[model samples]
Target: MNILILANQDLASNLALNLLLPSLQRHTLRVFLSSRVGKPGALPELKRLRFFEQSLCNEMLFPHLPEPGQRDAQYLSFSQFTPLLTSPVEIVNTINSDESLSRVSALKPDLILSIRYGGILKDPLLAIPKQGVINLHSGLLPDYRGVMATFWAMLNGEREIGTTCHFIEDDSIDTGGVISACRLTVHSERSYLWHVLQLYTGGCELLLDAVERIAYGEKPVARPQSTKGGYFSFPQAEDFTAFSQKGLKLVDEEEMLEFFKHYYY
Candidate 1:
């Protein structure tokens, strides 16, 4: 099947692409990375994009992986078998205007996979694929829908955090058909960054499952999300601080060191 991936350049989206792209050999895949690059002095841009990067970077989720080797390994493991992707992967610094949605349409993809593309996909654009578009969200749909669902789940002290692969409807947000979901328990001692990376890794598997099921002409499942349990956006600074203070249950430093060594080595 021919697949087109719509994604951004941030860690989450980039990691998703890194894993997903190499797996494209199984299906004909084309990737278009929506660039998050900005002008040096762009006022609102720095506040919105750079600030989030800095804040999340400092939070220490995956351990300061400044070294390319460490970062590559973390991304590759999540990719599983996708690293075999031999198809063309194009990085577009901006998909807002100059992006030829037409060129993407020309690919005539059997399916489109959207993972945090960071922009609204209009009908004229989403209509290109022969099969419908789908998204793998960080939160389990019908409950937590929107940006930072993983973080929001952590803040809420939810026992489980997971991924939702859903069909794309005409709506702007998460109002869509359910495809499939995968969830895992959040360890009290784990940092929010750790929790999110786990979710990110798990999401790749769930997404692959959803793709295979749909490719086989099967109806995965579609359930309406409860209006009562609605959307939540990113948390504010004060809220984050409060959650940080209470969310993590302390583990002995030696135990933590041993655990890190076991995983890192």
Candidate 2:
């Protein structure tokens, strides 16, 4: 299977590629990474990813950090990173113009997997693949929809936080057909990174499962999502304080412990 991946350079997206790269060794897999320039936040996962683009100042890769020992580059926009980073097997760069689309079209991809690419897919782009495009969203669909679902899940004090792997459809957000879903506990004190990591892992597993099923010639089922539940971005600072005092009722200790170990240590 020829796989084409679209993602930004951040820990979550990079870690996802780390997992995805090994699994996709059996087939011809090419990755296209896009930079999210002008976006202010933690450095995107794309920075850590190595590709074949002209060396754009290694300093740009390691932006100023608030604290010593931490690399603090702002996040890369989907448009910025798509055309800069490319490798022999993976084309990493920012997609600045329509010409990039032609390059993608020429790949003749069997599957196009998107994680944190942060862009919407349109017709001809979606039609390029035989199996169509798939996204491993960080949030569960219907129950937790919209941007930063895992962060919202943590802020909301939800007992379960997970990932949703689904087929891309006509909607702008996560209103697509569910291929498979997985959930895990969210302990109290688990930071944004913790829940997102869980979501990443679960989403990856579900995606691999979907891929294998597709490889075996099974048409994966797609389920319509319920419209009753939906969510948005992470909680504000006040919201976090308020949740600590009133809104958030619970947290998971084991998960929090793991989160601290991985993130803090």
Candidate 3:
């Protein structure tokens, strides 16, 4: 099966690539890079991206990797994936643009996969793929829908935060039917970034499962997302205060380094 991926260039995207790309030897993979790839937008995003690259450099790649240091391979060998991280994928700036949509249609992909591509796909693009578009949403559907869901989960002081893989539908934020979901317990002791990474790392496995099921002509269960409103946007100041009160650090460098050690090693 030929799978087309639409993704940005952030830790989530990078982590997704680390897991998804190498595991796809059974299928054809082509990537449609999000226009925002490699470009930092807002301040919070900028800071986290910087931290992810610099702090996690020992375990992953960076635009500029630091001076050489002897270290055993963590989880996956970062050296082997240099090609995927450095090489450019075809950029699809607007998923709705006629030219972009036409270009995508020309690919004739069997499946279209999206991981925080930062753009809404129109009906034309949706209909192009034989299997329809699958989105790896940052949060669980019908409940934690929208941006910063993992953060929201932490902010709400919930015990579980997770990633959801769903079938994309027309004209909604994350109204897609659920394909699969995996939840990680919110260890408030863990860094906020560590929790966020679960959305990418664990999420991709769910995505791969959905892909295999669809490829085999098996109908994976698609639970309809709830109509009741629980949509969320970026967090407000008070939310951060709540998060602080819950003893969740905005960024915990050492905790995440240990997290990488345990996850990757």
What are the C-alpha RMSDs, in order, of all predicted structures?
A: 6.1, 8.4, 4.3
TM-score of every candidate: 0.73, 0.71, 0.81
**For residue 51, what is the lDDT in candidate 1?**
42
Against the correct fold, how does model 1 do in TM-score? 0.73
Task: Please give the lDDT score for candidate 3.
Answer: 0.72
What is the per-residue lDDT of model 1 for residues 107-195, given as tens digits with 9 covering 90 to 100?
Answer: 67888898877666667666777778888888888788877677778778889999888878765687688777889798878755456
**Please, what are the lDDT tens digits per residue for candidate 3 over residues 1-265?**
8878888645567678778987776777777656443344455744564567344553354433432333343333333344443234655677788888877788788898998786777788888888888999878677888777778778777888888899987857889888888888887777777777766777888888888888899868998977984888766567767777878777776865665563333
The local distance difference test score of model 2 is 0.63
lDDT of 1 at 184: 79
What is the C-alpha local distance difference test score of each model?
A: 0.64, 0.63, 0.72
**Cα deviation of 86 in candidate 1 (Å)?**
5.4
Candidate whose TM-score is highest = 3
Which candidate number would show the highest lDDT if scored against the true structure? 3
As a whole number from 0 to 100, the lDDT of residue 241 in candidate 2 is: 64
In the range 1-265, model 2's lDDT, one tens digit per residue, is 8788887655567557656665666767666756542233332222221221112212333242233235233333222333322343344554434676788788888888987775566666777889888998888788887666765676666788888898887636778888888898876655455567656776788888888888889968999888778756534556556655743432344643443333223
Lowest lDDT 10-residue stretch of candidate 1: 74-83
